[model samples]
Target chain A: MGQTNPLRSARLGSRATDQFYEDLRQGAREGKPVCWILGALITTPMVTSLGIPWVFADALAAHLAARHQQKRPEEVAEEKGYLRETCSYTRIHMGCTLLSEEDRSKVLDWQVPNPDFVIITDGCCSEWVEWGDDVRKRFKVPIFTLHVPFLWNDKDRDEATNYVVGQLKEMNTFLEDTTRRKQDWIKLAEIINMGRQAQDMRAAGQQLCRNIPAPATIFDWATALGAVFNSWGKPQSVEIYKSMKQEMEERVARKEGAVVGEKYRLAWDGMIVWPEFGPLSKKLASRGANVVTSAYMWGFFPTLMDPTDPLKSIAWNMVDVWANRNLDWQINHVAQLCEDYKVDGLICHAHYTCRALCGQQLELMDAVSRRLDIPAIFIEADVGDESFYSEAQVDTRLQALLEMIDAKRKRRA
Target chain B: MKAVAGVDIGSLTAKTVLLDLQGQLLSYSIVAAGMVNRKAARKCLTQAIRKARLRTSDIGSIVSTGYGRSLVKFGDRNITEISCHARGAHWLMPHVRMVIDIGGQDSKVISVDSEGRVANFAMNDKCAAGTGRFLEVMSQALAVDLAAMGTLSLTSTNPAQVSSLCTVFAESEIISLAARGCPTVDIVAGLHEAIGRRVVSMVKGVGIHPPVMMSGGVAKNQGVVKVLSQLLKTDILVPPEPQIVGALGAAIFALEE
Candidate 1:
């Protein structure tokens, strides 16, 4: 019940996230162009390298949920026709954006400024497109949508590549026209390479976890996702991931463990309960179990691209994020992660509202479970809504999983 | 010289099983939890103690199980119903590798190994579609006695189609069918078929290794057992007193401890 042992560099992520907001507010304070990129799509090197500070639309919503302040934003969003059953993270985003300046002041210790421009990268679902249109109307700002197609390695792969390249070019032109700043090709390439380096380092840290007494738990990596989320193109990510990798390397050398008495090593397959991360991590640690690897913990590791060719690089990242892929791809991807991590079991946090991630979890769970010869459990929860989670139900399911694992260990022994 | 006890406090009922030093059953009792579950567990334990004619001090160990296991303050240990049911069913029928336990709020299929250890399990804890409460709601809608619905199901020549994933909605659907002159026997049969199909889906996920068995209050319903056995294409074993299976499992753990 104490803080999870092998204390990770969790504060690094918190610092990175805080610095992200500060940089955005600094852009707003200086009256510079600040853009809002909705969804995890292709809105990257072009905007950030142009000296225009950008923020992911749902970033603050995730922050609020982690800090346990989702109630007020949710209430406000509900009053404005956003239902609880429809993505609480989006509802909170809409709520904060729609709030009157005075009301927003009352609800916040800080603020997210209205964007000077909005780019809707609606590849995975139609929700982001609608959210983009709504924000465009509200701010009356210039908006561009890169219609990212969902085919990376299909027979029509070349067509998908050309389609995204054309859109990315047009979007770059649109950005140049809106901000009156010429595009910098060399600088763009430099940023992509840096992001590649950072992503590679993060991936390396994850790979080192194949060691027994895994040097890092998923909590360490999941918390530090802010580096990948906020500062991928910046030197900050390189430094953050470098330190992270060094810590993991040192741990691996010393044969130190992230969990105190780690008896089990499992992997998480879906979105985390951000607010309950500490409690959940501690609870698992108390049981001598460590969730050493997770699907989301590596950030953009699996979305590997040709960093030398920047357009192809961004295009691949834009199209192949796990959210946009089909079930077959997801099942194989999860299976590969389990094999790489050598996990004993899997826990899929089936967030009720996330149709994109959890849509095929049952089939994925069954297929991967049979293929890998390990058991997987599904825990029902929502990304940011604590009220939607059932603590007792989750506890019972997890306990049973541990029992099954124990039986397996006994049989092996 | 000493006896061990197991107390199972479920959503709808609490059961207590007492065992003598030789691991032989001494006595057991079941009490409806009503709205006050903790009180029900105490009363069930008290009745079992009286029947066994033993004082509380004579019990050397107690293991509590089921949904309300956490509320049993005097319990030496609390185990999940999933494990309890698996151990109990496997003890009763040594070859039983699967158990279908339908409690008041949830239903679960537990796969057991040869040694009575849980190999795998899947639960319908998110919904009440295939649980005892689902049948109870339908029986109330049909004006049939809770115990009589099972017998009536066996007489259903033409079982009606009752397809609603939700228990509350299923009740309304049943009512509409009854209004349209659909027979209660047919509807009861439909309910049993629905629950049987749901449990089969769960069992398949855990990969059925059978000598399948049924346990819990719903196991007393012969029609449900018959339907479930037919659906799985295997003869199912039911303990003579199935309601105390979880408590029995817990008592086994207490005895071992």
Candidate 2:
């Protein structure tokens, strides 16, 4: 999946992921104040403005898992009485904390240094706040918690955004105090503008996939997202997205799909199965199914962020996302994607250990299937747990989806 | 272009079906899917071709299906067993709105529309619980013949409790019941009831629309069917030869090809 892609950003994205690891290791050696944060609200601007290194806990877990290096971390977490049912990313990150000196050297590619402080948000799930508190206790680090209310009414959007924006102001003081450096407000504005350009380029790249033969597969976007997520607000991210958008334009002009024989255009939900990423992509491409879009990738990245009023814009973007809404919001979100992508089927990865992310997958599949009149399959997987993945199950379910699509085509004919 | 063939290489058996130009079943054969399913696929297709008194060259197209569908190198195309089972079950009983396929190593419940197109499907995770393999293992542990367990269970007055979902644990639980002087019929009946409960619960979760047809190797077991029928509160329909339905459906597709 990696080498086969003609997209330059895919290659650069891999380098960007590698650079992320290198930067973390170098930052630790230099004793930079690193904060492990949950919720995507403060990741980009906070790190860029303060001129300090930061760790996004979930991203590191995904990095570790993708490298086939999460086994010992899982073992350490399980030994510490963290049930396998607890989020695998949480276990992987926490297990990194509990790793013995010998195990850490063997397991981790780069040392995951202890955080100077913790940032927790209940915007997505309360579980993050609890996991954040546990991290706070483990290292005796202070925890900064922010509350973003769940919205059932579209009218509550402004209220939630305003509330979260107020908290972001307090967060600036906390960052300044933790790092003993003043927050660079001017730098924050610049980074936020840069992030907006990057997001637009990436979104434009994704939009090109609505073509008959999708010029870029979701795997292409998902692969490059490693760099995009690692450096969302940085200059390099803008270049990465620009390259990706250009590749999509070139491929569409040439009538070349990332998947050679695109047949069934499908949408995916839940976390990407990081451990089996390449093989998963290869297998689907073999079946002529170009999975063109995902709710996970589409919903997580902010579509719009006001650089002028950075916190208010980020807060508004955060509250209106799929993760923060009810089941109805999620159902409509995916249905709209299906129509937009011309997707005839859906694959909802029912990640086994994702308590926060996976509860409504079955219901989501059912509602979307009925509402959109498309077939949906929920294949069991764990986002970071390689051992929990079953190739047979994945093969059977996805094959069934293709067959369903074929049958529908026949009936229409 | 007078006939088409379908080969289904499953976990336990490889089956092949041949259909004539008029879309009538000509002949079919089932053989043990040995360690090499590729070999079994070849043998099964050959046997079905010969049984129909037709040469290999007569097959207009070959569609392979089941878990080992990819291994059928001669297949012109391959469809997953889920779609094949739905198509085949509908061909056999057109009114069926659902098909419950419990094979050797896996089980799935497929919801279909009035026209028999697949609407939705749910399958067990990578586990052998609620499948024919579980019964085969339990029969071995209880020293009961696999085919006769169904009849013997029908004679039980009070069934023993067999609650473990894992095959090994369920085997141990049944053996423990036997150790305590529980009747073998009671234990066997309990195994049927347990597997019935497990599979029916799955069907219920998928929201069963009835006129349900049961297919795959497990359909041959009367006790499991009887128990499932009771739990689902619907009389289940079973084709004369259940395991060949997937291959039958594939052959149907080959006719269209």
Which candidate tops DockQ? 2
Global Cα RMSD, each model: 3.1, 2.6
Interface RMSD of candidate 2, in Å, is: 1.1
After TM-score superposition, the amount by which residue A325's alpha carbon in candidate 1 deviates from its true location, in angstroms, is 4.4
| Candidate 2 lDDT, A286-331, residue by residue in tens | 8788888898876655558779988886787778778888898889
lDDT by candidate, in order shown:
0.82, 0.84
Top candidate, metric TM-score: 2
Evaluated on chain B only, what is the TM-score of candidate 1?
0.97
lDDT of 1 by residue, B91-132 (tens): 788889989898877888888889998877888856668787
What are the candidates' interface root-mean-square deviations? 1.7, 1.1
lDDT of 1 by residue, A1-413 (tens): 22366545655877888888898898889999888888753466778879888878766677788777677777788899987887777877877776766666545634777888888876876778877887888789989988878764557666777888888889888999999998888888888888888878777777788988888888887778777778887888877778878888888898888887778889898878876877788878878888987766654635665557888888777766776677788788889988888888889888876777777788888888889878778888878888777777788888777877876787889
Provide the lDDT at A42 for model 2: 47
Residue pairs with backbone overlap in model 2: none
Error of 1 at B68 (Å): 2.2
